[model samples]
Target: MSEQAPAGWYPDGSGSERYWDGAAWTAHVRAPQPAPPAPPTDEAANVFSKLGTAVKKAASDKKASKDEALRLHEERAVAAGRLVTSGIFGTSTIEIYEHGFVRVAPGGERYAEAEKITKKTPYERLRSIAFGVPEAERAHDTEGPGSPIEGAVMQAMSGIVRGGKLLTKGTAVGIAATGVAHLASNSARKSNLVIATDKTIHTLTNQKHNGFIQVSQKEHNAVAVALVEAGNAVLGIEPVAVAQPSISAPPDAAPPAQISVAAVAVTPSLSDRIRELSELHREGILSDDEFSAAKGKLLAGL
Candidate 1:
């Protein structure tokens, strides 16, 4: 109207471009186009890729160094202080040190190419340590059938007590059952060295039956030697020996046989695993947080 405007594309308020024919708006139009994205450079991609590779390489290198260091350290560990664990989980070792210990998982001893690993725990975290039989073994020992003839004979004799009126048929049956159970449990006794820390409990058990009915005092003393070493390392004192409590006979019944596990013999000691971890830590293969985390996880398992 005031002057003929130049024919060109212009914004149409709806945000698309429209062609002005100098007299009126034209149907020719298009939505506003976005600028093309900048091309990704090889340098940027390479930076991240190289970084990842470097991280992996570093980890690999550290692992190799750690295993080498552990192997060397293990060579110097006291034979008595080096305890082995061989059971359902496989073979492992626990190397006890003055301040702490190492738990080397199965195959961890293969330095420079080990898939198994080690964890470290400070003795300061140790809560309690004792020698005893684990419930699993006790359950195993009591799983067999007892002497049926003995049970029946015992049952008959029990019925004769107190003019045959002291017990019901059910009571006689119970006594026979108890006698049978006792017979089954007389298989053998093995000891375990149980160490409990803030995070978990570690049990090192005897690999074989140390006795027929009960582990001998000599065997107990053998395990106690290892226990004393652990006690000194953790508690900084000696543990007192406590006598097993005797079960008294009931006034109306015969005295029931008791099985005591106090000072039971253990299979072996385990202290090498933590020692290996300490070796790695001292050599800077693992950092403080890494060592602590590894130790906590290892102990959390059996």
Candidate 2:
């Protein structure tokens, strides 16, 4: 909104990056950069916290054996979350696992305590996910989920109504409360991830604990990829071949006379060869044009 917005690359309302020359979008555009590889913490959940019964059951069936339940609850290291600061509310965090993801409230960064509230949504519940702001807004308009932040608030409120028994129709009350939450939920405005599940939509940002507004792009990208991977798994799909960069040959490559080698030795500098060509050119034994072109070809082999 100001003429002083620093010159840098910003999201151009699409998946690509556009250059902002401190005043307006420039002609220089580039393809979307892939999320860099970051090792995720092997954080796992031992038990469900102040989460709703529906959420708990969705992640792990209560009637199943303890071992089975524990296995189901194990959080995979696919996507690790970041801690975000909330004024007077401590820190909030989100954890993504193999099966689904969890949303922890702003009371603290940790979960599985009596007071901490959480919401878990399995990959099976996810219908679609969009990364950029414009696409996410379209999904939010057409999808059926409430805001992830509002979902937490609603879940907390559900506890109060459950004990009070002030209303005969609890489900109707939840529906009404959700409608209000949907309108009031603007957490996605600062988010880098947008998820639409069968129950609700999640718009969240991955930020460090001290900085409330700044997003951790590395962590957000990691979480975004992990979410999409999990969602794809649920839908019986696989990530694109370029998702994970590998130097090894493809599965179908033959071993005989393999030309696409992983590594090839390359000379760091060709100063010696250049010197030889320079001498030949100076001695008039080789033409200046021929020596200049031939000098570079020497490195192309060794």
The best candidate in terms of TM-score: 1
Over 4 Å off in model 2, which ranges?
1-124, 133-191, 208-217, 240-302
lDDT of 2 by residue, 77-191 (tens): 2232332221111123333333343333332222222124333322223455444432223344321244222333344346446663222253334335445344223223223
C-alpha lDDT of all candidate models, in order: 0.46, 0.42
TM-score of each: 0.30, 0.24
TM-score result, candidate 2: 0.24
Off by over 4 Å in 1: 1-126, 133-188, 197-200, 208-221, 225-234, 241-302
- Superpose all Cα atoms of candidate 2 onto the true structure and report the RMSD in Å to 1 decimal: 39.9
What 10-residue stretch in candidate 1 is worst by lDDT? 209-218
Cα shift from native, residue 197, model 1 (Å): 4.5
lDDT of 2: 0.42
In candidate 1, position 285 carries an lDDT of 32
Question: What digit string (tens of lDDT, one per residue) describes model 1 on residues 212-264?
Answer: 21111224335444644554554455445545445775578744545433344
